[model samples]
Target: MQFDLAVIGGGVNGAGIARDAAGRGARVLLLEAGDLAQGTSSASTKLVHGGLRYLEHYEFALVRESLTEREALWAIAPHIIHPLRFVLPHVKGLRPRWLLRLGLFLYDHIGGRKHLPATRSINLHRHPAGAPLKGEFGPAFEYSDGWVDDARLVVLNALDAVAHGAEVHPRTPLTAARRVDGGWELETPHGRFTAAALVNAAGPAVLKVDGLLGEAPEYGMRLVRGSHIVVRKLFDHPYAYFFQLADGRIFFAIPYERDFTLIGTTDRDHTVGEPIVASEEEIAYLCEGASNYFKTPITPADVVWTYSGVRPLVDDGSGKPESATRGYRLDLSDKDAGAPLLSVYGGKITTYRHLAEEAVDLMAARLPALTGKAWTRSRPLPGGDFPLDGLEPLKATLTARYPFLDAGTVDRIARAYGTRAERWLNGAEGWQALGKSFGAGLTAAEVDFLRQEEWAASAEDILWRRTKLGLRLSAAEQKALADYLGG
Candidate 1:
């Protein structure tokens, strides 16, 4: 195959760049080594926020950019991105309440926060969120962020890229690439392809990809491992908690899957390897961190699931892993000569759209074929063509239209696929028409949709990345679904 641009990696950054470039009239080919979002993209804290903590690091530009994109992302993909309130209890011995207030003040005003509510003080004893907290926690501050289906966000980007004429190839890793006279020849398992320009957005393995050309950059990347643990629901309320530790680190206890609480994120350097799993120490640290705030203590046994991802962060010479910057840098090799190669560095999920736009803008200067202007700022991803406030109404419409489906199933499908749910249902008049249910409202029809459309190749892709049905399905049922998909 031949294309105008071949984008490496299928994480958010790579997928986003492919989508933007393809939409701008560039014939794009996106290749991924595994299922989409099988890396750091899927293992994020799943919060779309301005990074209130980043203010402490004096990353005003990053904070502003992220705060700006937070709303823009929600506006475009409202089904997967929804407003969430974060409760920060003013624990003594940590950063003082005054610093917290000032940081929040900057957070509220920095990026032009309009629709989301501003920060306000609340008495922990009186607030519903405090019901799960310890007695000593008195006053707390509540601020707005957002919850996201991180993995789904990636798949949706790839879907939109395909919709816009890009060829997306998951499970196909780029084996090698050599710069030719006018373009480059790239190798994958399937076949060889040529492209006028190349993009290396390989999340954690970006540096490795850059090394393939026998050229090395001066700067290095720090592989920081962040891990999360999920347990039975810790609270009944909708608000998520931002608990501060005595060591000056912070973690979150957010409601997950309606029946569990999600807590995580330790910042330790990690050696990249296959099957990144959370260490026992990391799990214990997270449990202890949450136990310090919640009235009820937590243990490792309570954890139903754990996930870890290695972040390829720019090595800014920060002494601590958590202190590293999340901002990205776009490096263009052969900018003034030869075929252009753009390699993307560290970036956060919140700023992926801006990153992609900037990447394409940089590449457009070199690629004469890329004539289209910036347009993704307003274009909605696949299934995200509806209004931001229309999620519930759309859900109601789906329930009404598919009267045979239970309300819960309708809501789940509506949230996952948005208006595109209709496309998947495709005039299925009844449950039987939808095919057999493999538990958790997952049916043969939906599995077919995933395989045919979303590049889902395995049960792990469906249960863990495409949806969190893994948390709800039994081991036997999950195996059955896997068997069904294999057949």
Candidate 2:
């Protein structure tokens, strides 16, 4: 059977495309070479910000859309996504105060923002957010944005796409695709797909897809590698910190998932063949950039985790990372304009929904028979339908219901899985009833649910993708889980 749309790559843009298409009543199939979010989506700076600094670059449209979505995403997924205030401490001899103020003023007005609080100025010497900052930096400005579990966000979108009748295949590679009479014929490890339309959201490999379809005009994607690092907790406040470097670039240091702090995002021009590892140069760059602003300095030894990804940007002929545009571009091509293939380029997590709406809306003009309208605007994603202002009540209820389960253990599962966490906890009379412990929150039941429902096929899928338990698990524990999952 032919699908209305076949989306390649299972990262944010592709998953968002599948979910939006499926919701819009398009028969959709999404394919991923590896697990969903195993690439750039999982390796983000993890801020759903409006890109406050982008204002300086004069990207108004990109800033406006992302700022608007910041609140929209928060309202829909309060459990997995929440509002975070960032402190941008002002330093002497850097971008002057007037310029920074102008940037923030525009940043505040750019997006049709509502839920999040607007920017405010605070004295660094007196405020708590300033305690960690050096004496040279004085008062700072604070603003609100959203923070999210970037990996799990992809999973939730994929889950919603599946719930909406889209076929989501992970570990399924799209080896080849060929244009047919009216659509395209594509092959995967599992089966073949015939689709009326194709969405080449292959992300970093989008250029490769262009070559697959016989290189069309303006067919180029710039691969810029960005890396992130996580270290032992630096401060107590939940507010995230954005520091301006000497090079006019900014890096983030956020109070991460409770116990640790997450910092990073270095933009360096790189090739795909290069190992996506944090080099000594990058580690020191991030460490020094962050430490220069903080009272307590950190070193490579303090880093607990690190990851990298390549952003697939449309080649705009600009070489500098700061000047490179963040706005996305769509090149819909075909022999005839009516029935064409859509190739997506340069999208971020913040603007994904709007991007999907625009992509499918354009496709609908081609096929007027396509059913359904934009429903994702108000609809909740999978388990995100839980009713509450927060997940604390649900966490409390889970703790009470599963008295036999440890408080920390129940909280972790409940928050991560929400109403569906029961699939992991159901009728377990005691800790022993939950089955063998796999260390951390790696229970036998959770692992089973991951494989059965979330398309987890390996230890990396379970440990890194499904859960951040890898952050807490010792090497021995990780190895044990790997060995067991391998068998």
Candidate 3:
């Protein structure tokens, strides 16, 4: 089929770009090598905040754009996106009070924040947020951010794109793309899709596509591996904790799901030629970081689950891992160095909407018939037509309708799927009607909805993407799920 644009990779970037393009009246097709968001897009830190730390590196533009997007995304997917308060405890030697205070000040005012609250100082010795912390630490500060269901955000964007005239296919890997006529003919495991414009949003595998066409960019990509650990419940507070290590880098201990605390993220240079796994050293380091701050220490035994992802950052010659630019760059390449092949590099999930708008804008030049300016900025993402503040009413009405669903399950599904929960329910009677139960509470009906509506092709795709049950289910349960899916 001919398309105005063909996007490779079903990750958030590809999905977002395709959605924007299709909404702007461009015929678009998005192909994923595996299930949607099975890659790095599913395994993010899950924060939609302006990189509060990026301000430390003087990344004003990236921080500004990302912060502005935080409110937009929360507005669009309020159920899945919500405001999170982070507690930044003051350490004696790591960072001075003035520096942290200044950072928080810029974090609030730097980005034109409207919906989120401003930062406030907290007495660690007195405030409950710091009761779990070591006594020696001085007062701390609290700031606002937005947390997202990182993977489902990608799926919802793809769903929106599909609703807006985009062909979204999963488990359909790209094979090759050779320039044909005035456009590009792309071959995938599924079939051939011809397009005048091609986009490489393959995350780590971006250069792989470039190599196939001998049109790779001049700069190489750095694959930085990051890992996170989910431990048994740590605290009862709703606020997330951010601690700076003695080594100057920072790590977070956030209240995750209901019965666990999520801690993570190490930035080590890596080269993953195959499926990546978390290094033992990385796991140990995370535990040690956790031990250093919390009054109650946790060991490796406390960690029930672990996950890792490779961040595909454009190598901007920054020697330090933290120095790499978080901003994305669009490179247009072609067979004869003239055709339009847009390859995206180094972007965060929070800023995807603007990036998609920009991608569509560039592709519009290739097809002048596609002219309507950007509409996605204002369009509700599928069920997001209702104001985010109004979700409580929807939840009240849903619970009143189906008392069988536990508060957790209903709230989670409502937040994850938003107003579309009705379609998933499809007049089901109760929990049993929702289908067989997975250990962490996801049902077969929810799983089927993932497969039919969200492009989930594998158990991992459903468990990890549409939901984070992978972190909550036991090994036996996971195995049963794998077997149930015919794995």
Candidate 4:
């Protein structure tokens, strides 16, 4: 189909841009090579923070923008985003307490943190979160950030884009594209499409997508692999930990999926062709990093699941992977020559929305057809129409309405779909109405909703991205899901 805008990736940036542009009255088309968020978007550290550590590298602009987005995102997607308290324990040889205090003071004041609490000093000996930490670490700093279901965030954006009259195509790769005088002729396996503007948001393959048009940008990209591991619950509290390593890098240990703790994120240079696997060394590194602070030591053997994602950071001559900037830049391809091609480079998950706003603003300036003002700031994604603090009350209402479903199931569904969960339920009278049980509370009704509404195609997309049911499903259950979806 012909359109005013064609987004090349289904990750957060592409999805966010499509949603924003379409909402502003542009005819937009979003194309994904695989399922939405099947790459870096889903495999994030799953946070909506302002990059507190970025202060060390003097990225005040990025940190300030990200800080603002923390609350904006939580405000828009409360079901999938919520405030989180982080404990940054004060170690002896590491960053000094005064420096930590000063950094946190800036972190609090940098962005307007209204709903979330401000930073405070915590006595580890008395705090409940300290029970799991070693005695050597004490008097930690507590700060406010936000947590997110990264994959769901992207899906919700895509859903909202579609709702705003944008055409979203998953698993449709752009095989070739030829730049017209004032538009683009894109060839895909499905069909040929034309657009007045093209957005190169292919996360790790941003450069590759640009090359499809027979040119590359003036900038460079550094592919850094970050890995995370999931282990049995290490602590029994709602608080998450930010641990500093001796090598000057930092990682986090956060609660995950109610039954486990998610520990992660090592930054190292990785080649393009390499598989996205949590290497033995990386797994061991994360385990060691966590064990240094937690009273109960951890090992690679204790890891139940591990995931890895490569960050396509802009190469700014930083010597170490951790020093690369998380900020994004919009490169408009020689607009004076022809229709504009906006290539997004080097962005973090926390700043996707802001990047999208900037990208679209640039697009509007370059392309006359995309005449629209900045929106999406106050617009909520699909299912995110409720108040910021309405999740618990919404859950209560859902439970009261559907008493037949267990509390856990209701809560899971509510968190996943927010106010829109009712759309999936459709006032079902009882469990039987949900249809064929695939185990782990996954039913045929839910599967049908995923397939029909959320662009879910395979068991992996349903289990891993759309929901984290893969952790709860057994081998047989997963196979059953795959077989059912296959048939």
Candidate 5:
């Protein structure tokens, strides 16, 4: 296939770029080596906020850009993204109270605060979030951020790209690419194609792709692996946590799926090709960290599930992985050096849309066919047309229409598909009409919709990426789902 732009990854950056380019009238092709978001994009801390700790490092621009984009993203994809309050308790020994207050003040003011509430001082002993914490934890600060269904965000961006005439092919790896007379020639497992421009958004594998293109390395990468653990709910309240360890590292413990609490993120330096599983040491570190604050002790045995992903951070010579900058760099090939090739390095999920917009803008300068201006900033992704505060109403509507679905199922569907839930639920009058049940509210009809529309082909793609039902589905149920897909 020949196109105006070809994006070479299906993670959030590539998907967002494809969506933006295609929306602006460019013919776009998106190729992914694995299922969409099967890598770093899905394995995020899953919070959309300004990195408050970054203030100490003086990453003011990055934090400001991320903070500015936080609510903008929520406005467009309110279904998968919503406001989340974080409780940052002040420990007497670490990060003094006045310093915390100053940081919070800057965090509230610098980002063009509009709708989300401002930070407030609270007594941990008096607050509902304090009930599960140790008695020693007294004063705390409640601040605003947002939570995201990380994997689903990638899928939705891909879907929106397809809606705008972009061809998205998951599981198709790029084999080769060479600059040609007018543009570039590309090879993949499926076939060969040509394009006016090429984009390398391969996350951690970006350096490998650059080597394939025979371009000298322009930047060093620090592959920092961040791991998270899911356990039974730690607290009954809706507030999440931002805990600072004495070792100068921080992690979060948040309310996860209705039945679980999600805690994470250990920042350890990772070598390329290393297994991206949470190490026993890392898991213990997190458990010990959580136990320091929570009244109940946490251990590896309490961990129901663990996930890890590497952040392809630009090597800025930081002393620790946690101190590495979350900022991004865009390297566009020289104009006289043949066809334009853009390589993306070091970005976070919270600023993907901004990164994509900037990427497409760079490409537009090289390829005139990319004439359309930036439109993703305000436009909603697929199934995200409702207002920012409209989730409860949307859920109520789904419950009223599909009375047979339990509250858990209704909330899941409404959040996963938003206004698009009806696309699968339209004609089913009852559970029987929705086809066979595969446990945990996953019906055959819903599976079919995912397969037909969202490029889902396997059980892992369905249970894990398309939805997080893997957390709840059993071995037998997952096998049944696989068997059903195979048959």
Candidate 6:
């Protein structure tokens, strides 16, 4: 097949670029080695924030860009994204109270704040968020950020790309690519294709893809593995936390899946081929860190689930992994180098849309078919056309329409599928109409919809990536699901 652009990667960045380019009139093809977002995109801290800790690294431009995109992303994908308040308690010795105030001051003002509330000082002694914390923690700072269903965000972008006439192959890996007389020739497991331009967004495998094209690595990459642990609910309040350690590191404790507390993110240098599972030491470190703040002590045995993702960060010679910059760079091949080649390196989820926009903007000059104007910023992704504050009302509508579904199921459906929930619910009057129950409100009808609409072929794709039901599904139930998928 021939195309104007061929994007190799199905993470958020590649998917976002496909959506933008296809919408702007390019014949686009997106190829992924596995399921969409099976890599770093799915395994994120799941926050859409301005990176408060990055300010300490003096990444003002990156932080400012992220802060600016914060609300814009929330506005476009309100169903899967929503406002979250973070409580940063003051530690007596670490980062003085005044510095925290100044950092937050810049955080609120520099980002063009609008609908979200401003940061405020809080008395942990009187606040509900303080109830589970240690008594020594007195004053705290509450700031605004956002939460996201990271995997779902990637899927939604891919769906929109398809809606705009982009061809997306989830399991097809790009095996080879070479520059030719006016464009580029690409080889994949499925078939051979040609394009006028190519984008390498292979995340941690970026340098490997460059090797496939016989190109030298233009920038250094620091692979930092961030590990997180999920445990039973530690606090009853809705507020999440941002905590600091004497070691000059920071982590977050966020409310997750309604029944669990998500604590995480350790920064350790990681080699490319090493396993991505959270190590016992990393889990114990996070558990012990949470213990120091919460009244209840957390231990490794308390962890119900653990995950880790390697960040492909630009190497700036920072001694510490956490100090590395989150900024991204786009490099286009010189005109004498034949067809255009754009390679993306080092970016975070919060700034993906802007990164995609810049990438398309760079490719537009080389490919004339990319003549249309930029339009992703104002356009909502699939199933995200409602008002920014309309999530509650959307949930109410789902409850009223599908009264047979329990409250938990209704909430899950509303959040996961948004306006598209009705597409599968299809006015089913009872649970039996939805077909066999697989535990945790999953049904044959929902699974069929996922397999048909989304690219879900296995139980892991449906349970872990499409939904977090893997945490609730039992071993027997999971086996049954796997058997049902014929895996």
In order, how many clashes per candidate?
0, 0, 0, 0, 0, 0
RMSD of 6: 0.8
- Per residue, candidate 3 scores C-alpha lDDT tens digits across 273-383 of 745777788889999999998989888888888888888888888878867878888876534665588888878888999998887787777776477788877777866
Model 6, stretches more than 4 Å misplaced?
none
Better of 3 and 4 by lDDT: 4
In angstroms, the error of model 1 at 308 is 0.7
TM-score versus the correct structure, for each prediction: 0.98, 0.96, 0.96, 0.99, 0.99, 0.99
Query: What tens-digit string does per-residue lDDT give for candidate 1 at 54-80?
Result: 898999999999999999999889898
Q: What digit string (tens of lDDT, one per residue) describes model 6 on residues 1-487?
A: 6899999999999999999999999999999999999999999999999999999989899989999999999989998999999999999989999999999999999999798999999999999999999999999999999999999999999999999999999999998888887888998888899999999999999989989998778899999999999999999899999999889899999999999999989999999789999998999899989999999999998999999999999999999999988999998888888898899999999999999999999999999999899999989988888999888999999888888888888888888888988889999999999998999999999999999999999999999899999999999999888988887
lDDT of 2 by residue, 1-487 (tens): 7798989989988998899988878889999998999998988888888998778777888898998888777766666777788898888888888888888888888788766688899888887888777787777898888888888888989999998889998889888888788778998778898988888888888878777866473556677888888998888977898888888888899977678888889888878789977788898899888889788998888898888888877677876965677789988885564346888988888888888888888778775535778777777776667653657888888878888667667666765777778777887777777776788757778787888889987888888777888888888887777776775
lDDT at residue 129 of model 2 (Cα atoms): 86
Candidate 5 residue-wise lDDT at 453: 96
Model 4: per-residue lDDT, tens digit, 1-487? 6799999999999999999999888999999999999999999999999999999999999999999999999989999998899999998888999999999999999898898999999999999999998898778999999899999999999999999899999999999998886799999999999998899999899989989977677579999999999999998899999889999999999999988999989898989899998999999999999989988999988999999999999999999999999888888878576877899998999999999999998888876666667778788878889998799999999988889888789878988999889888999889899998988789999999999999999999999999999989999999988998984
Prediction 2 TM-score vs. true:
0.96
Q: What is the Cα-based TM-score of model 3?
A: 0.96
Instruction: Tally clashing residue pairs in candidate 5.
Output: 0
- Tens digits of per-residue lDDT, candidate 5, 70-165, equal 999999999999899999999988999999999999999999889999999999999999999999999999999999999999999999999999
RMSD of each: 1.2, 1.8, 1.7, 1.0, 0.8, 0.8
Residue 438, candidate 4: alpha-carbon lDDT:
88
> Against the unseen true structure, what C-alpha lDDT does each candidate score?
0.91, 0.82, 0.83, 0.92, 0.93, 0.93
Off by over 4 Å in 1: none
Clashing pairs in 6: none
